[model samples]
Target: MNNDKKIRRSRNRLIAGVCAGIAEYFKINPWVIRGLFIILLLIPHIQFVTICIYVVLLAILPAPKGSFFENFRAHFGEQGRAASAEHKQRSTSTSNRRIIKDVREHDIH
Candidate 1:
């Protein structure tokens, strides 16, 4: 396993991406890490320590570039772009039709 890869915070984060980053680094499921964290918090007198560690991780780990949703959209490649373009075209066409209708109604008055 390569240890040199910098552990950056994940964009797909509910809280701070600490668990996600650790899961990604270790090739494990993020839920498992999150569960472990919750379990750790439940231990007697460990809640404070667990919170401190989480905060420390948040402070130390660098955040990954771009947001999770952006990355997810990027993965869809051309299909995502095409959908966005088509939506914009439809919006403009609808607006143009509305404007033309309003003008025709005004001219009849």
Candidate 2:
């Protein structure tokens, strides 16, 4: 719930959440992000470079509270505020929290 660091989306991850996280940051679809990444890779040896960049970004980026893309949607003024607030709530909630959902489900068995 820290306003300073943007959390990446853990629920969405095709490739380390790099494309999905960036898409969420920019309020775009993860598919679009993945497409752009693929296009970027098509250019000569950029694939390796892009992979490296993705890896580095993934390691450096923080996971978003719920849907990683929600944070970026906050830039749109009113909607952004609402989305940010919703994300904060989902992130900070005592129950059904994203990170804990896994643990809770595990305990259910």
Candidate 3:
């Protein structure tokens, strides 16, 4: 029921919705942005440089916080949130093994 014009999160995008979000914002076809980038990439002099700059800008520019990552992640499965949480838990536990070991030792008393 969400009537917002935000880009569909289920669709793959180049960079955190930079192309899709803008297209949605302007009510234009997102493919146009993709095509423009492709054309820019085909340019001889500044293709690589332009793409890099666009990527950098996309990463730095905030796009409604979890709006970008979560939306993209949702496409994976119904358990996307749970999977992400479990992955985070595993990573943190591995990284904090020393701290966990110390706490366990103290608790042995």
Number of backbone collisions per candidate = 0, 7, 0
TM-score of each: 0.57, 0.49, 0.44
Question: How well is each residue in 1-109 modelled by candidate 2, as lDDT tens digits?
Answer: 3456465655678656778877776776789979988899899878899888887887677656645344554445578788899999998887884443445335554
Distance from true location, Cα of 86 in model 2, Å: 41
TM match of model 3 to true structure: 0.44
Worst 10 residues of 2 by lDDT: 97-106
Off by over 4 Å in 1: 67-109
lDDT of 3 by residue, 21-94 (tens): 65666667889977887788898998989789777757654455356565564566558777899988988785
Per-model lDDT: 0.83, 0.72, 0.65
lDDT of 2 at 11: 65
Alpha-carbon RMSD, each predicted model: 10.1, 15.5, 10.3
lDDT of 2: 0.72
